[model samples]
Target: MYDRKDPYYKKAKQEGYKSRAAYKLKEIDKKYNLYHQNSRVLDAGCAPGGWSQVLLERVKNGVVVGVDILEMDSLNHPAFHFIHGDITEDETVERILEISDKYDLVVSDAAPNTSGQKLLDHVNSVELVQKIAELTRKVLKKKGTFLFKLFEGEDKDMVLKGLRKDFDMVKVVKPDATRKNSFEIYVICRGYKGEQG
Candidate 1:
């Protein structure tokens, strides 16, 4: 949990960002430069619009489409669009495709509602990440990038191996904004190799 007195928390509030999670993307982009002006981006599990705000600022002339199961209040950014639906649903995918044919970047910060059972949580998280990866293959442009959040566990190796088959470079990254005690880490995959037959 972020302490209200912490510098990051204060900075986020002062800067008008909805949440400190915005810094995670900032740090990742500092390393990967994932967003480009006019790039098309898909943000999965976007809620409260923190990451979407950062994406909007980075992709000046670009478009950002964010999807989440929960309703989000209006973001008021011309470049940003939000869809309220389950990303795993076919209807959601169809809606996303209607906005753009190929996306340059796909970012997922999704996590299953935890049951407080460690093993079960890890398994569920990995499964969700895999589902996002599969969706990335279908929607991403050739050579697009995928960034997703994952929890470290025995199942992580399997997840990384599957990602290796789809991306030329796959790296596990832990941003400074991520809590040290948390098992959460972002999997950064660059250079999509096309759909698996």
Candidate 2:
């Protein structure tokens, strides 16, 4: 659990960010150069609008469309659109496309609720991440960027194997904002090459 007095939590409040998770993306983007000022971005599993909020500041005139099964307090920006639906559904993809044909970057900080059984939690996280990856295939532009979080497990290699064909480089990183006791790792994929025949 996040300590209310955690430095990041306090920092978030002072900085006007919706959640302390905002720092993770800020740190990741600084290292990876994830999105451009005029880029189109899709933020899946976005709620409370922290990552989406950061994207809004960074994208400038670009657009950020966030989707989640949980209702998000609407982001008050002309360039920000929220799709309140499960990203695994066809309807969500259709709604995302209605805003733009494709996105220049797709990011997901979303994770499945952990049940405390490490193996069970890891398996569930991988499955949810795979579904998000499928969404990336549908909405990401050629040569786009894909970033997401996953629970570390024995099956992570299999996930990486599938991504090798679709992206030029795939790497995993743990940001400082993540609780040190946490098992979550962020996968950063670049140079999307699209589906292999």
Candidate 3:
């Protein structure tokens, strides 16, 4: 059984972190060595900015640009930047390109608004993951890392196969911080192979 009183939950409240999702990214970075002192990151679906906090702390001179559909209260961190918009939109992409330099990493935690249908939920999750993958290929620097959330389903193999074609290595990870009952998993892809024109 999962512990409701996990240390991360306690730490989040104590440290004023916006969400427990912060520990998920912390653990992912710790295990994969993703974030670095000088990294420039684009965070898609960053709303409350938990992951942005982690990135800000890890990267010494790093800059973090976050985008989400929801409005975020002003954040004053020197290394943190936020843009409110839909990442799937071309205008939003152009806006990101304007503010972003070379991206060392791209992290996405986007999820569809669930409709309570299991099959529909799975399909929506898969589509979001594919969309993130496509955007990563366009915006990420060569050898940049891409991390995004996905749910296990029939489309899992297809997603993995497509990822393999563009990434040197793609791994599915279930972080210890994630709930065991939850269908969510993270796809960590390293070394972008450059998108075809």
Task: Residues 28-138, candidate 1: write the lDDT tens digits.
Answer: 999999989899999999997889989998687879999999998888988898999988888989999999988999999988998778888899998888888878889
Candidate whose TM-score is highest: 2
Superior by TM-score: candidate 1 or candidate 2: 2
- The digit string of per-residue lDDT tens for model 3 on 47-152 reads 8888888888877787899999999886678888788998888888888788774688999988888777778898999988887787788899988899999877
Q: Candidate 3: give the clashing pairs.
A: none
- lDDT against the true structure, per candidate, is 0.90, 0.92, 0.86
The TM-score between candidate 2 and the true structure equals 0.97
lDDT for 39 (candidate 2)? 97
lDDT measured at residue 123 in model 3 versus the true structure, 0 to 100: 99
RMSD of each: 1.2, 1.0, 2.2
Quote the RMSD, in angstroms, for model 3: 2.2
Off by over 4 Å in 3: 1-7
TM-score, structure 3 vs. true: 0.93
TM-score for each prediction? Answer: 0.96, 0.97, 0.93
Candidate 1, poorest ten consecutive residues by summed lDDT: 1-10
